[model samples]
Target: MSPRQRDRVRSLVADSEAPIDAQTVAAELSVHVTTARFHLNNLVEEGSAIAINLPPIGVGRPRVGYRLVVAPPVDDLMLMLVARLGETPEQREELAAEVGRAWAAKHLPSVAIDAELVPDPVVLAETILTRLGFRITDVVSAFGQHEITLCGCPLEKIEHELPEVARGVVRGLLETALTAGSPALAAQYAVAVRPAPGGKCELRLNLAQVADSTAR
Candidate 1:
């Protein structure tokens, strides 16, 4: 089977609100039932998806269903905020950053700021991104800045459709994480999301020159 087809099947499982059976997968992809089952089983074996017993629909035996092992939580509030907040794209993105900040504060681990302890922003970034189901590809340090490349965003669909808002979300998450660790260092750095060579996105942290700025 083609890798793209398998990825599509995985995406279908990730996007669905309810568990999907082989029959449903076959119908959706217009593939044979055996082919669908094969892909679903492969996903289960690979630990990306799981098989579960679905509720019986007036039948003798319950059907088995496939679902993502770690399905990303749907953010209906983000959509509502997007629709109600702003008239223009820029306004929406600006407001969305606030929403993202609040989200990161709630979801990310609480940090105890210590004056003596210097926090590594990249570590905090990895913690938050991994918790949010993003796959980080590479982290490069150059020119007094660090660039983190990531793919397989949990909110891939939303990121694709609302790029401005997506950028806001990413920006807020990074900024808030940095601030929690060290307000001084946070002020010295700026976060920007840029497109990478492949489908990956880069989180570039631009450091501004300020002597002893990180020292507390």
Candidate 2:
């Protein structure tokens, strides 16, 4: 972030209500909303802002809002360095995935142990990811395969070099679902990831494979 750009972003809402939208910022700054969105998006990527969508009372689309976040970027460089410190690509991926699983286990409610019933954990994954800042673009399900597209990755770093991070998140979500859901059925499930353009990606879990695994 450049000095002038940083000043422009910070000067917009030094003393305003939180969770403001780009439109509000543009209106106040007397600039186009797109321009405001650009700066706000930069702010979000820089960890100076948080983006959220508030569901409206009516039937229209939810309103997207931004909340200012004030914190030092202490972990920025450390995360980058640590993320690269792995013996091999496979080790790095596993390490990243482990981090994600740990995060989920620590943050999410404990799954019922030896309980009467275990529900589908996949359903819970969507909700958790949303709260963690991944927006669902669409869900496609057919022929016993389920696929979902998320608009943005929670990690701010570029997706190409650090796909392990995104993959780890998906793995974490699924592992938690499996632990919370049916272990037997979970053993039959598998996850496949495909990177998309613009910080987006697709996750697939195909139940069709369950039949094949059963045959084996």
TM-score of each: 0.56, 0.53
RMSD of 1: 12.8
Q: Which pairs of residues have clashing backbones in candidate 1?
A: none
User: Which predicted model would earn the best lDDT?
Assistant: 1
On TM-score, the leading prediction is 1
Task: Give lDDT: candidate 2, residue 136.
Answer: 71
**Residue-by-residue lDDT tens digits, candidate 1, 160-196:** 6666777777777777887887776686677777555
The sequence of per-residue lDDT tens digits that candidate 2 reaches over residues 1-216 is 356755666666545576777778777767788888888888789887788896765898887787778765765765677578576756776776677667766666655555555554446557656766777777777765666666545554534456666666666665655555566546556665556544344444233236554542
Q: Alpha carbon lDDT of residue 201, candidate 1?
A: 41
User: Candidate 1, which segments miss by more than 4 Å at Cα?
Assistant: 1-84, 200-216
